[model samples]
Target: MTTETPVKTSNWNVPNALTTLRIVMVPFFGYALLHDGGDSIGWRITAYVLFALAMVTDKIDGDLARKHNLVTDFGKIADPIADKAITGMAFIGLSIVGSQSGEAWYVAGGEIWWWVTILVLVREWSVTLLRLSIMKDVVIPAAQLGKIKTTAQGVALGLLSLPLVADDNAWGDTGRVIFYVSQVILAVAVGLTLWSGYEFFRDAFRQKRAARA
Candidate 1:
């Protein structure tokens, strides 16, 4: 009887390592944001730097995975988790700080409008669950609009993370402008997010119907 060769796996490769690094950075990023109640400019800067580094790792890891054929089940699962953790933390932290400080235009009556967070979370978690449910029979790849949404979210969060917007410094006006622009970008991201969620559900339904037929 001829022996069968074992299939090689690259789960422990550089791409996955970077993805793990991104996951590791999430707490540090949150700490920097929450340190001293997010009042210290130094802490905010540190948070922004950590966030940027984590975002960079996101890109590098995906590129490396695709380029070197290092993509694995672990990477596929962990990569999105890392992305959501970093970004979700950023959004929650920003909303909390905005509500407390009354500085963020997005906040009103000392409340950061729970609707925004609720909408985003609902879409994200629902789609993720739907994907998992159909994963055995269908593979739903990331769409172009989804990538745009991610980038917009990242840029908006990065802009909001900076201390300039909340400080009464020379750059305060600039910071305000950036903050407004970031809000616009965030709105676009939210729209795309909802649209993509609809598309995902639509496609899943169509596929299920087709398989039944």
Candidate 2:
């Protein structure tokens, strides 16, 4: 009887391509989001489309990689980076839009708070950095809470990316409704964001402590 060895899959695959495409889309998405200082209604709509594309591609690539056994080192690294890049751009760009719009921007009490952006980004990046730093020594696998956080964030940010108010500060009834809904969703996301961060740090610290013991 002869023993067969497992074959190593090549990195050139659909999932990796999608991940790379997502990374490439980040800047273009940001550009569209911030076009005309976030006042270009057309560009804001364009940005929303681009953002939706990124989110869909992200889901597709991850599914493809898992289903086809095409998971590679590159995918692992680039996938999270792509996710972070797109969302980070959304947060920052939306904040800029909110700051520029002033009182008129407060449609139905909807505005992207700079403090919220900073807090969420800090928690998100800190987790990513710590995960990468201790990946070899202590693997802290992602929790389900993280997925919920991501989904909530995606929905909220996508809504906020739209030009919810006119340049002249006239907010339509529908626009106001949507803006208020998005803000409510964002508040939920922020809560989840903090809770998930706490879970991640708790798990990471426990793992590290166990390893040292």
Candidate 3:
């Protein structure tokens, strides 16, 4: 008699599955945000709720993968793709809407600035290309500043969503204050994101030099 080994099922990978869910939700979230009349606060609120849930899944998948040793290349690649899809779309859509409304320059414009959004997109896309060029074996772990940038982004986006809670008093002067604060936070976040990208490049260069030596 021979003992048979149980085959590990790929379906059992929770982290990769969660990341895939996030990717799938990105288009749907974008549609909801862009399709809605932009007048109803409910639509924005719904979009925000979906965005928040996606973010929660990000945290969960990372924690679970780390704790259970279930990390995989699929998870690594899909996670960032999901992030870019969601954030890039949100940043662009908000800015477009704000600009079209002709209130982008106003203090309560509710629009994301094009320059700020472009900066984020450039960083995300550049790093993504760099990672692909270098291959998966060359791991560039998230810097401390990167984590701070993520935190700041989450806070700012959340505050922006707050204005969608009601119609009349949904986001009065208080919400404007929060919006302004978030703008500052987002500006800082962008600065940190660039700094973190530079750090990654510097570390990568040093490693290459050492390898050549």
Report lDDT (Cα) of residue 75, candidate 1: 88
* Superposition TM-score, candidate 2 onto the true structure: 0.91
Give one digit per residue, the lDDT tens place, for model 3 in 1-213: 999996543645888888889888888776666554344566677767878888889889989988987876677667788877877777886776566655543443456878888988998888877776665446678877877877777666655644432347667777667667877887787888788878878877776677678
Model 3 segments beyond 4 Å from truth? 1-12, 164-169
Give the residue spans of candidate 2 off by over 4 A. 1-5, 108-111, 168-171
Flag clash pairs in model 1. Answer: none
Q: Clashes per prediction?
A: 0, 0, 0
- Which candidate achieves the best lDDT against the true structure? 2
Better of 1 and 2 by lDDT: 2
Error of 1 at 188 (Å): 1.0
Per-candidate TM equals 0.89, 0.91, 0.86
On the 0 to 100 scale, the lDDT of residue 78 in model 2 is: 85
- RMSD in order of candidates: 2.7, 2.2, 3.5
Lowest lDDT 10-residue stretch of candidate 2: 102-111
What's model 1's overall lDDT? 0.78
Error of 2 at 185 (Å): 0.6
What lDDT, from 0 to 1, does candidate 3 have? 0.72
